[model samples]
Target chain A: MRIFEYMGKELFSRFGLRVPKGRVVTTAYEAAWVATEIGSVAIKAQVLSGKRGKGGGIKFADTSAEAKKAARELLGMKIEGHTVEKLLIEEKLHIDREFYLSVTIDGGAKKPVIIASSQGGMDIEEVPENKIVKVHLDVELGIHPFIARNIVRRLGLDVGSRQGKELLNIILAAYKIFQEKDAILVEINPLVFCGEKIIAADAKVIIDSEALFRQKDIPYIEEQTEAEKLAQDLGISYVELEGDIAVMANGAGITMSTLDIIQRYGGAPADFMDVGGGTDMEATAKALEILLAKDPKVIFINIFGGITRCDDVAGAFAKVKKEHGIPVPVVIRLVGTNQEEGRRILREQGIEAYTNMDEAAAKAVELAALVPAGSL
Target chain B: MAIIVDQNTRVMVQGITGKQGSFHTRQMLAYGTKVVAGVAPGKGGSKFEDIPVYDTVRAVLQEHQVDASVIFIPAAFAKDAVLEALEAGIGTVVVITEHIPVQDEMEFIAYAQRKKAVLIGPNTFGIVSSGKCKIGIPPNQFFMPGPVGMVSRSGTLTYEIAGNLIAAGFGQSTAVGMGGDRIVGLTFIDVLKLFEADPETKAVVLIGEIGGNAEEEASVYIKEMTKPVVAYIAGKSAPPEKRMGHAGAIIRRGKGTYEGKVKALAEAGALVAEMPSEVPEMIRKLLA
Candidate 1:
């Protein structure tokens, strides 16, 4: 769950991190009012995607009129599939320098790591390795002040100076937020050095979805795509892809392997849909209906039945085919746990169920080739 | 030569009074696993399937000299259940519960490391030493005692590959589901080293997905390994940043990618199969 920038800043401020006074506005008029209230405002588009500055989604306005114009222009603009419905208007500052800092779970290390860089306000990838500092925090030891001081020193800031002391406080406070919030990532891009104080100019926070039960009162903004919403409604796992063929499986690993085989056989998967274990007829029909709604040229269903009976999947595919009077080609590979009975049911419905995954994937890809790519 | 459990290994089923716990406990018993004891907090002084039940792992340890523990507890109480097993000096703990929070996982992992215990998973199908002892919910008929040691991240994928391996005349010595969650207990490296040491295992089949650098890290270990390894990396066609049902199956920052994992395994001299069906043939050729 990603908290919006304004909410991130609000959470950061609550944790003792210094942030510029900001207000979230949904309209250009509201943005203008906030800009007038706080002179020299920065109108930052409220979108989840990064690189907002490079995308021209963020703009600086010296006057209220200019803020309103910038808001109007960015309000309806699209950045990485997210429409800018809101803007975060904040008091702009005269920054002496900018530094990037973040606390995120280093997947490789399986631990929380603090990433600090002297070069900030841009992509961390662009920064050289020598300038960036990474410190992996141990579960037993945690983030010590000395660790923060070392990172501060590596950032070329004097540990004895006032600005350095303030930066250390910010890093410690940010680490506190990372621990308290059960956050997957908490990043403050451009922790600006303005005169005597340090301010967080932009903030990003992603809370762990599994930790939501413990993290009460967090304003979690779940931005699900339409397909994702429908999949969630049906209690199925679905992820949309950029292709012309829909793929369905009983398990995540099998689904992925199905996608691999389809692509290997010169086909592209339109979406990934896993019906999960022991899915009955109604749920299977719903899953197929959801995939059909995407209007793919081909639908491939792969089920290595195991404890989940193949007859259950077969009956569901038949029921779905009959109910929708399916137009697109449906290829199913059902094996193990009553596979013969499953194939018999599919045959009764005038549908063929292959026993081998390779044969079924090949057939699906061959059928998919009959239609032009992306024609769906 | 099974790595984790065998006929001599005495096992205890934690949370054996619950629905999933009781069901899989029965399955494990039927599979000839020596399930000596059961731990259900409120269901003490009771017998589940004629096996003794205790309120806690410590009490269960008093009656039976259990060597390994299989946990079927809910995700909320899994941390305590695992710790209880470790506290009772149980060296091998297999957590079959899914959806354990990452923080709890970190704590338990650290605790397990301190105790010098082998923790399998908080979300796994559990380990099965083929035709000898089985734990957790994998369908047992798909397996047979053979020379190929299998390790995988996903449950159903393990079943599929194991079944295919059986059909292709290459039964497994032991199949370990390392769990699909982001923070699993026994990683690929841990199990790969076990397979390398087990004398009965002639070769190994590693099943991986687009997840944390476990596979990439395993590839580095595999480079140093002498035994032949065959790998099948899933999500080859999966889109970047899309969570493919598994909590750990997303690619971020050019890491944990299907292509990167496959390339790394290939570079390490492991045959990377395109699909699960192709795994058995590759493993057979390696052993041949």
Candidate 2:
């Protein structure tokens, strides 16, 4: 969940980070008004992915007329699959110097790494390798004040200037904001300097998805439909497809392979629902219910246990059968630790478990063909 | 010495009251897995499949000497649940929750290593052995306790391959889904080592897909293994950008590309199959 510059600034401002005073507007008139107030402005389009400039999503405007024109052109433009419906008319700043500062997750390291550079404003990827500075920190160590000061010093910010401490303080504050928000990435691409004061000319923040439950205060995107929301609420993630078989399973890899197997077996998965690891009977039952709700032609529960037990899933099937009728035919293929016990439980409960995924999948397709098509 | 779990395993479920947890918990109990207890915070003192439900893993361990735990806690609390399970002296913790924050995973994985408790997955299907108790979610319909040992990065891929094995008249000894998350407790090589040593496991099935260097890394282990190993790698037709599949299966940064993994595995002297449908036949041919 990436936040645009307008939202990023709100967080940056709280940390005493400096930025060129500006306003965001959706209309041409408002854009012209901001242009008049700020004198000259940078007419930037708001889109999700990076490299907005290379995508021709950004333009500079000198006069109010030029700003309005640029904003109008950008407001309806599409950049990298995202529509630039909004424009950020920022006041043009007098940048004496610019530097980079960022906090991002290093995927391989599984930890947050703070990335900084003496060179900024231009593409960070193109920046000279020697100019960048990086620091990897443990989640427990956190971003302390000393670390911020050290980062500034390494960037040679002390160049005998009073702005050094101010820059350090702003960057430090931003780091705090980053941690508080559970941000996956908080970056100030160009921390601008004008005379003795430094300001955040640009800020980018990406919220970690798993932290969404904890981030009650942050606004969330409401793009998903009601059914999608319900599926997410159930803890298992699902994506609807055009296939006839509804696939439900335990892991991302499992979910994907379910879809692929369905395709290879001459069937398509109507949807993908991953109950995730360590699911219980109720969750598994609900996952099955959710698949049923999708009104799939056939339900295929493909599970390959590594830590999760098959007997537990069998119990979920029995429970679901007891609680609610399985509206559609189900083909369950589960194998992993405690598999025999899981099979016995399923057998005792009168729910059949398919030892072979291919056999079960074929059964699902055969069963799906038995049912007539109905709109969901 | 089947990988991950065998008959001696004492299993416990952490969110047993929930639909998914309860269902899988019963499966573990039914599989003769020595399931001692279940844990669901507010549902303490209750029972799931005749197993006592405790508030915490400590209580479960105190009541019954359990060594391994299977977690079905919600994504938000998955990391904490796994940590507590490890702290409770559960040597092996299976986390079946997905979408756990990367930060939570790093801390838990690092700590689990220090605590000497193996955490299988934040997103995994679970582990299983034929005729023994099972944990997590794996289909038991196809398994008949044969000589094949299986490990996979993708759950369905494992299922498809294992199905081929079953169809080919070979049953699985123990099948482990090593998880699809970027960081997991165990690796393909780790499970391969167990399979190589297991007397019952005459041949091994390794299911991999495009994404991550796991397959390439496991190739080295395949070379050292004494038994014949059959391999299958997917993602040959996956789009360059995330293939909209497994969270970790989406190849990026050119680290675990499909071509790279398949090439590496084939080079390491393991018999590699082309597709899921081709797996069982390839294994049978190699064994013969």
Candidate 3:
């Protein structure tokens, strides 16, 4: 998960990388107080999305009153759809030179890659490819001392020089943090050399969500839409999207295929929900309830039942209709293990489940088109 | 012969006494797979479903000379279980446990490489060679031995496409789930290479989604292969940077997009199907 800059910097400090002293404040008054103590601070809005500087979510404050004004402008403002709920006030740095360094998994290579460049401040993509030196770390042996020195030397810094030593330390620390935190990425956009020292001007750390179970100390921030949160509470995977048709399936592959088929037939899917394998009747009912909250014009349920029982899905459909009453048109396609029993259950409930996926997808799209836009 | 396994392949089940282990073990046995033995750390000297249970993989290896091992241990102890199987000289290890720590996977994958062993997955559904043998949890009815070679990242999606192929009068030579994780051991290229060399396999079906460079990398290799290939990529409508059920399914930094994968595969001469149901028709046309 992507963390706030303050959290990333906090992690950097713990890993022995130098970061400018920073304080997190929630209100404009507190931002002013922290800025006064820091003396010429950078006021950064603590939102998850990047490009905050270009989006005007970041500001420079020379004095306490200026900091207050900047904070006021940043607070309660939405930058890239995320509101600035908190501000990170950090001591401004005087840099002799700026460089970039990051350690991230190269998905194609299936190895950890270190990307270092002499250019900084601008987007890494904007930097010319020739100026950047990329190195892939061995997954088994990890980062050798020579590999670290190679990156720093290529950046044109002397190994014995203060900035060079500091750069090496920062690179090592970043790799350590990336490894220890089970992080997918750990990046310092501008590792600035200030006279005799180097400090991380900006930091970004993204922890692997699947590895969160082992890293118990790191706090997980649940950033989700209201509909997403509702699905989470029901123990189902849900992703909110634009459009009027609600899409539900028993597996991730079928769910995505269902989504694709709907769009192929000129229908827009409002959400993506997967009930997962071996789901029972109650869980299916809960999944239905969560999707119902999205209030789509059509609800399309597709189950390619393997270990997942179709009878359970049919039972849930019957239960949900008998209790909550579905307001929209429901289209379902059930196949595979226990499919006959599932179809029988749905048929008894006066709801027909299609055996062909193509037929079901077309029908759902046709029904969705029949409803006027914004009618739901 | 199939790429990974056939009727003659000897198999062993690790964590055989556990709930999922016993359940899928029975399923595998019922499908005519040569499940010779089982291994549960403390369940040695016991028998599960008429199969001898050993405490360690070494002991199981002593009696059966197993060709592959399908692991069904809990996520917490999966790394050690796989390591044990690798250490016991099992050339092929299929890890069926999901949610294994990435660190653990990294270590085990490196170790497996050192031992010259093939690690299928840390979160896979294993491999099935149609009517010959089945080593995974895919429903038996969805498969029938024939000429199509299939490789997929997701388990259910593989089954979905396989069922569609069967309904359309096509059958699979070998279907492999390469695991739906970021750091899977067996990749699309790895399985594709095997399928390319297998005589029974006539064409290839690559099942991928909107994450990782597996599909992109596979396209590079497919550009040279002579066998016809058809692909179905999921998550075409998925949002960027959101985990869509599968942990590996995400679009980050403008990479791993559905359109990009489809374009690459199409450029490599592989027919790209818009939906799972469409894959069979594409394969039929390619062979025709």
lDDT of 2 by residue, B160-186 (tens): 566667777988898887787766778
Best by DockQ: 3
lDDT of each: 0.87, 0.77, 0.87
Query: Cα miss at A80, model 2 (Å)?
Result: 2.3
Question: Which CAPRI category fits model 1?
Answer: medium
Ranking by DockQ: 3, 1, 2
Q: Please estimate how well model 3 matches the true structure, expressed as its whole-model Cα lDDT.
A: 0.87
Q: Once superposed on the true structure, which residue ranges of model 2 sit more than 4 Å away at CA?
A: A95-100, A119-134, A145-175, A193-198, A222-376, B42-46, B189-204, B209-246, B249-272
Supply the TM-score of chain A against the true chain A for every candidate structure. 0.94, 0.72, 0.96
- What RMSD, rounded to one decimal, does every model reach? 2.0, 6.8, 1.5
Interface RMSDs of the predictions, in order, are 1.5, 4.2, 1.4
| DockQ of all predictions against the true structure, Cα-based | 0.70, 0.24, 0.72
Candidate 3 residues lying further than 4 Å off, grouped into runs, are: A226-230, A233-235
For A1-376, candidate 2 gives per-residue lDDT tens digits of 6778778888787767777788889999999999988888888887775778789877788899998888888897888667787888898888888888888765445566788887988877778888888887776667777887888789886734587778778767877877888786788878888777787888788776668888887777544456666777876676666677888777665566556666766777787677766677777777777777766777888777655668778888888877887777778887776889888887776668886666787788888777876634
| Reference-based TM-score of each model | 0.96, 0.76, 0.97
Q: Give the poorly placed runs of model 1, Cα more than 4 Å off.
A: A322-324, A371-376
